[model samples]
Every structure is written in C-alpha cells, then in structure tokens.
Target: MTETFPASRLWRDIPDLLFPRQCEGCGVDLAGNGTLFCWDCLAALPYLKPPFCARCGDFVAGDVPGDFVCASCARRAPAFDLARSAFRFDGALAEAVRRLKYRAGVWIAPGLGAFLAETWRAVPEALRGRVDFVTPVPLAPERSRERGYNQAGLLAGALARRLRLPCRGVLRRTRGTKTQTKLSAQERRQNVRGAFAVRAPYRAGNRLWSRWFPPVEGKRILLVDDVITTGATVDECARALKAAGAEAVYALSVARGNG
Candidate 1:
C-alpha cells in the first residue's frame, strides 16, 4: 500500500514539480525561492563602480581627477541631462537580463527592480527634485503585444513605487521597428530614430496621473529602462520628451551595456 503525503505538502510542491526553478547562472535548483541566480553566482556578478561617463554611463578605466567625458559622448552628446545604470550588462547580470528578456523570466524582475531602485536613490542631489515623474521607455506596440508585457514597464513601475513617484506613460512608440540586438550600433540609432513621440494628453495634464502631478508639460522626467546599450534608445526617448515641453530628461537603467 502506497502512503500519501499531507495535502499541504503536496499543494506546496505542485508548482515546483510542474516547473522547476533553476539558477539562471548555474542551473542549480532554486527550490521555491524566486531568485534567478543562485547565491554563489549572484555574489560573483560584476557590479559597476564609479568613474563612469557623466553622459552615457559607460564604465571607464583608470582614475579620474574630475568629471570626465567618454570619447563616444564627446563625439556626440546624449539628449538626456544625465544617465546612470546599476550594473554593467555582462557576466551574471547579462545572463539574468537575457533570460528576463527572452525566456519569459518575469520572476527576475523583483531582484532587478531592487537594483534599479538603488540606482535611482543614488542619483546626485543636484539632479534630485527636478524629476517630476517617471516614465518607462516605450516598446513598439507590436513587440509589446507579442511579449504580453513590457519588461521596461515592469521595471519602471517597481522603481516608481520604490521612489514614491508616479509612473506615467508619457511616451509612445510611433510604430513597429526592427529589433536592435542584431543591428550595428549605427543601425540601431537610425532604427529607433523618430520612433517615439510624447502623447497629446501627456503634453498637458495626464489623465492617468493628474492627481499625482499636474502633467508632463515643462516638467523634468526620469526615464527608466532595463538596460542601456549604445545610449541611442534612451537618447531618442529623451528627444521626444524634450520636444513635448519636458524641461529636462534624465535616464537610468538596471544595467549598462558595453559602449
């Protein structure tokens, strides 16, 4: 005669058995815990340190006596007032983001959101108070529908909650465009160019968040995203925000991709 376990035990184990949670970095079973990377791999992630570019947030080598500008930013300035990221998009962080992006890994958003919140808190005091509202970088409607949810939107909402700021959909992607992963950096720039626009309502009083704040008109905005690659995407997003009478635009991300 076979013996059965308690109902409570069986109920708790169902989800794990049906879909085992494993480390995104090492494949070790995560046991019911909601972390993408196991302890060891998470500890080994290469977190970004200071001396990065003031404009694009790229990691810079060597010591700096004062504010330094990366060659890329010097060549062409970004549209946003400032930019920062919590971590460099490589090693464990990169893998985790890839899974979060391509593998329906919404489970990882909590941990990533913590990193993003910490990044937001660290924004310089001089830049503080200027951010009137937070907005997520908009995805093309076709891509957003395909994914069923926008990862950047998830991050922005989580971050806004942490910062006690209202998250608003101030920007919209004008149309569908090609994926940026396969394109060259220059190609990536042109692909997203003119793809974003500030919606009419957000230009004045926002219907979704009017009680929280008057509107986006002539207000500073903090643009939230999952990662910053060539800075082109956020730059374009900022361009649209500025055009919509945003006094200034600042950008932040969970990870900063290689320049």
Candidate 2:
C-alpha cells in the first residue's frame, strides 16, 4: 500500500511550506499553525479582568466591593449605555492596534475582531440580546481617503461575521478634527462633540438600501472600534445614533486605555 495526499491539500500546503506564515508579534515561522499569534504572545496578552468601571471599561488598580464607574464616567455619563474592551492598551496589543491604525495593517483586523467577539460573549445576555446590528465608528473623509480604509470598519465587519450579525456603516464624520492623542480627557470630549451624524437610509429607488443600509431607528446597535481611550468618540457617535432614533447603543473595542 502507498500513502496518498489530496491534490488540493498539497497545493494549499506548498505555499506554507515554501514561505511559512510568520507570527505578527515575534516573526516566528508558523508553518502549520492557523492563528496569527504564537502561544507565548497570546498568553502574554494584557486581558482586562474584573474591577473595571461599570460604565466605561477602564481598568481599576485596587479591589472594589461593589459596582463602580470611573471618575470621568461619573462626572458625565457617556451617551452609550455601556462600553467594554478585551484588553488593556499595553504590550503587544498596543503595538498591534497602532500598526492597524497608522501603518495600514488591515491584516490584523480579523484577529483583533476575534478578541472583541470573545469579550462580547461575556456581556450580560440582557444587553447582548438587544443588539440588532453592528456599526463602526466612522473616520473623517480626509482621513479615510489617506488611509484607504477605516480600521474600525474592518474590525466591525470581522466581528459581525463572527457573531452572525448585520454590519452597517450608519454614521459619518461631520467634519475633520485634530488628533486626540495629546489632548486631555476634557479636551478630547469637546473636540469630538457634535462631530458625528447618522446617515439616513434612502428608501425609494434603491435596491441596496434594504440590504446594506437598513434603518437603525428603534433598533439596538453595537458600535465596534479598535480602541477606546477617552470614550469621547464613541459617546459622540452614540449621541448621534440615538438622535437618529436608535433605541440603544453599546460600544466594544479591542483595547482600552486609562483616560
């Protein structure tokens, strides 16, 4: 008897054998591995654990007996009902997010979106059940033209596929704003206020509207993004969504940073 391998299998394996996929974090050869991250890198991920804020997902250092909202959230509650993230914005996760956002590394979106999907499963069913659709935080027209893609949109599409939910681009940036990296939390909030608007779906004489641009009115939405720093962008987005008649909006992101 002679051993046999399928032609399709051989064809698929040849490329991997010739030039194995490399780990995105450490550049380790992944000849047969299916995932993007190696075991060590995945294990070292800075996962956000308990004792985080109830409203926003900021990591709290010390132990707390009961529910707590961060100072920023308490000062002025965000428009979104809740926000959560998969990991703290540090270590390799931070680097991955930066690469996706600034370096046009869209390849990493699916992996990061998987993290968001896993984190979403831990959300209470009461809230998760209410989510009727998923949408991304929109990028400005200028930035989208320069980047050629919206990283948040990529993440949202990946997540929606995993969760079997409809993904739509329902919001648009009203205008371009300065980068929020250097701004204080207060300034960040002010900068993005009124910066987003919901795009009204065209009802007549459009075939794509029913499939791709369904009305969000009276529907619950899940907003996906690459990271949540000050919660300003998502809050503004939520405000616009609600103003457009969305019943509820909950936010999820790959990483969260202390604001």
Candidate 3:
C-alpha cells in the first residue's frame, strides 16, 4: 500500500523543510514544533501568578490576604482604573520584548499579543471592566518615524482582533522624551507628564482613508503596550483619555518591567 496525503499538507511541508521555524526566545530550530517557541523556552516563560497588586498587577512576594494593592498604587494611584500583564520582564520574556522594540523582531509580536489577550481574559470582569476600545500608548512623531513602527500598536492590534473589539488610534504623543530605562519612578512620571493628547478625528486626501473619531466619552478603553514598568507611560495616556471623557481606562501589557 502507498501512503497518501493532501496537496495542501505537502505544500505546507515544503516551507517547513526548506526553512525551519526558529524559536523566538532562543533562536533554535523548531524541528517541526508548530509553536513560535520550543518546548524548553515555552515552559520557561515567566508567567505572573496570583497574590499581586489589585491595581498595578505587580507580583507580591509573600502570601497576602484578598485584594492586596501594592504600596506604589496606595501612595500615588495610577491614572488607569486597573492594569495587568501576562509575564514578568526577565529571561526569555525580556529578550523577546527587547528584540521586538530595538531589534525589529516584529515577528515575535503575535505570540506576545496572544499572551496578553489570554491574561486579560483571566482578569475578573469586575476589575478589567467593560473595555470599549483597544488603543496603544502612542509614539512621538519623531521617534515613530525613526523606529518605523510602534511595538505597542502592533500588540494592540493583535489583542483587539482576538477580543473582537475595534482598535483605534485614540492618543498621540505630544513630545519626545529621554529613555525611561535608568530614570527613577518620579523622574519617569515627570518625563511623560502632559506628553499625550487624545488624537482627534481628521480627514485625509482620500475620504476612505479618514479615521472615524473615537467615541471615547462615557466609554471604557483598554490601553495596550509591550511592557509596563513604572506605569508612568500608560498612566499619562489614561490621563489624556479620561480628560477626553472616557468613563474608565484599563491598561494591559505583554510583560511587567522591574521598576
């Protein structure tokens, strides 16, 4: 007897044999594994578990009672109603985020975005709220031109598609600032202050190209980003969104940075 297979399967196999998929985390040949990561790297993903902040989603160190909000949130609350992340920014997750941001590893975005969508679904409805729109923390015009793309926007689009929501460009960066990597939390907050504005609707040369003005007033929004550190950036974005009459804003990111 002769073995048989579908033509579509054989066609797909050609690419797998010609150019094997590599693990996004470690750049290892996938060896027919259908995932973006190899078994080891997938298992090593630093997923954040419970016992975290009720507001900021920072991982708590020890056992805590119900509804633990971190000291940072208690001291100076974030502008967003709530926030959460899927993974801790370290090891494989950190490398993947860096690659997506600095090294043009846009291919890694879909996987990261999937993780974000999964994390958001796990949040209780009471906390996550009714998200009306999904939007990215905008990049400044100059920085955006230089980078060629916004990593946050890519993540936001992927996440919104999964959630079956309308993704819109609801905010714009008003100015460019220095990197926040080495800045103190206070400095970080100051740097991004008044740096964002709600992107207003505008008409382009082609009427079809024009964007519909986002109806944020009295509506909830979910801000998406690649990572959240001091939460300053997202908070600034939330500030702008709320000022524009958004009822509530919640932030969701692929990973949580050490702040």
- Candidate 3 has its poorest 10 consecutive residues by lDDT at 1-10
TM-score-wise, the better of 1 and 2 is: 2
Q: What is the Cα-based lDDT of residue 204 in candidate 2?
A: 88
Find the candidate with the highest lDDT and give its number: 2
Cα lDDT tens digits for candidate 2, 1-259: 1123335654666654344477767878777465667888899989999898888877889898788888888888888988999999888888888877876566678788888999999987864566899999999897787676899999999999999999999999889998888899789989998999888677788878756877878989999888899888999999999998899899999998842
Instruction: Tell how far residue 226 is off in model 3, in angstroms.
Output: 0.7
Provide the lDDT at 141 for model 1.
80
TM-score of the candidate numbered 3? 0.87
TM-score of 2: 0.89
Superposed by TM-score, candidate 3 places the C-alpha of residue 145 at a distance from the truth, in angstroms, of: 1.1
The residue-by-residue lDDT of candidate 3 on 65-108, one tens digit each, is: 88888999999888899999999998888888887787555566
The Cα RMSD of model 2 versus the native structure comes to 8.1
Q: Which ranges of candidate 2 are over 4 A from the true structure?
A: 1-20
Off by over 4 Å in 1: 1-23, 27-38, 202-214
Clash numbers, per candidate: 0, 0, 0
lDDT of each: 0.78, 0.84, 0.82
